[model samples]
Target: MSGFPPAQIIPPQVLLGAYAQGVFPMADQGELTWFSPLMRGVIPLDEKFHVPHGLKRSLKRRPFEVKWNSNFRATMQGCADRERTWIDATILESYCLLHRLGYAHSVECHDADGLQGGLYGVALGKAFFGESMFSRKTDASKVALVALVERLREKGFLLLDTQWLTEHLQRFGGEEIPREDYQRRLKVALGKQDGTFHPPALAPGV
Candidate 1:
């Protein structure tokens, strides 16, 4: 039986344009695809959702530290570490390129040991397009997210776009809104960017 060829490489310019237009690329199997979902998932920083009791307890127990943009490449690699991940080598390289262009970001959660859980994504205007997150310990990622949202809100960011919603996200008040509504929110968020946030100061372990 015959097999597939390979996924087409998305031009960097095209990727940037797509993001600017509220659309993005995806790949189902072997094809590079673009999509603008009608129903968008987002977490409003002002209306921050509740932290689960178990996670809250976890946070208090471990007291993990939060870091921002400390290791962009490391965070991306960690998130893409899983065996069945959608983030291939090409996509990883693309994310790194975006970081170099001042469009990508990474939020790290760790402790006195080393890296634990965290997230990474694109930062355009006032919107934080969260791409993916990984958790090596419970509530570690949650603390990182809480700190990120606080910092964003403090620094005047307007939107936290998670792209698609999940049960895990629901705890953080992630909600689905109509495409038009989302676009409207995006407009406001993008318009309210301040472009400044404090960097993390955590050491290799702490």
Candidate 2:
């Protein structure tokens, strides 16, 4: 991380600043590395948004109960539990601090198996910088994502930043924008006064 500032434990305010500037940190060799992808992945919070038919069917079946910020730390840990991950101890601790400040939130999907899947992210103004997600049961994470988008849309959010493009994200109309274009969009999103990661209530029980 020669070109970047040295990794000190990131304070919540600084973390929010980084997100507002269109960058985020992931641990590399136990040190935080800041990333600003040249092509940024973002899901449109507009008419372009679409849920796949299969996922819609799953949604209809109501396989998981959706909740927001009810288990933030646990959701972060779940996302970090896979064989390889960027959500190291420092990253986890940093985000937990943000959650306490109301700038970070998790959307969770729970079934009889406990927390089946979920995702976490940082919110600034009208932008949601989606950090990571995980699923222990089939389609659990997807369900959580749908719930999240609905909440964001209902709250008049303008941006859903995914950081990088992936096939999984593409199914929901996620697209890559040039860094400059993303920055422009980010600027507009951050200019808005109201944005929130917390949903008004836990989603209806599955």
Candidate 3:
């Protein structure tokens, strides 16, 4: 990964433009920074995408009610609720604006107790950037991930960018590719006009 200091406030257009070029921002030690990794992590949107046997069983149990764009800020907070996080105030505010503009979204899992887990990310053309996810209950975040993949597939999305590969994501077919290869795929995804975060035929429930 390579990075440089960024402005305190990243405009929505700038953020979208950066995503188009395969760069993204994070907050590090209260400072904004931009990075484009040498190897990019992506989750397959096709058949290669996997749901582990255990998670498949959890899916059947319907542990939580899945919803889209419901409590987006809360979902971001969930992802940021860890001990050390990159989702600082500036990152939070910028992404919230993106959500308002319909470029950012959340996949939430809720139960009788309240919000259990979820994820938040940015959607542009046929690409969806998986920023971060958090779980408040067992498998709640995993369920939300499964639901997100299904939704993206239903809407004909072609790319699922994870930024970096992690062991947690490898089970779900997440892999890292050279930045050049990633940029090529990103271009193809951005060129397509049919993909969208929200489609009229689909409701928020999953």
Per-model lDDT:
0.72, 0.83, 0.85
Model 3 CA deviation exceeding 4 Å by range: 1-8, 192-206
| Better structure of 1 and 2 per TM-score | 2
lDDT of 3 by residue, 1-206 (tens): 32324434577777887888899988888666788999999999899999999998988989899988889899999999999999987788889888877788898999999999999898887789999999989999899889989988998888999999999999999999999999999999878543233422222542
Once fitted onto the true fold, the runs of candidate 2 whose alpha carbons sit more than 4 angstroms away are 1-8, 192-206
TM per prediction: 0.81, 0.89, 0.90
Give the alpha carbon lDDT tens digit for every residue of 1-206 in model 2.
32323334577666776787788988865767789999999998888888999999899999999988889999999999988888877788888888777778899999887999999998777888899999999999999888889988877788999999899999999999999999999999788433333322222331
lDDT, model 3 = 0.85
Evaluate residue 164 in candidate 3 and report its C-alpha lDDT on the 0 to 100 scale.
Answer: 97
Q: What is the lDDT of residue 204 in candidate 3?
A: 53
Clashes per candidate (backbone, < 3 Å): 0, 0, 0
| After superposition, candidate 1 runs with Cα above 4 Å error | 1-13, 28-30, 192-206
Better of 1 and 2 by lDDT: 2
In model 1, state the lDDT of residue 88. Answer: 60
Q: After TM-score superposition, what is the CA distance of residue 84 in candidate 1 from its true location, in Å?
A: 2.3
Q: How much does candidate 1 score in TM-score?
A: 0.81
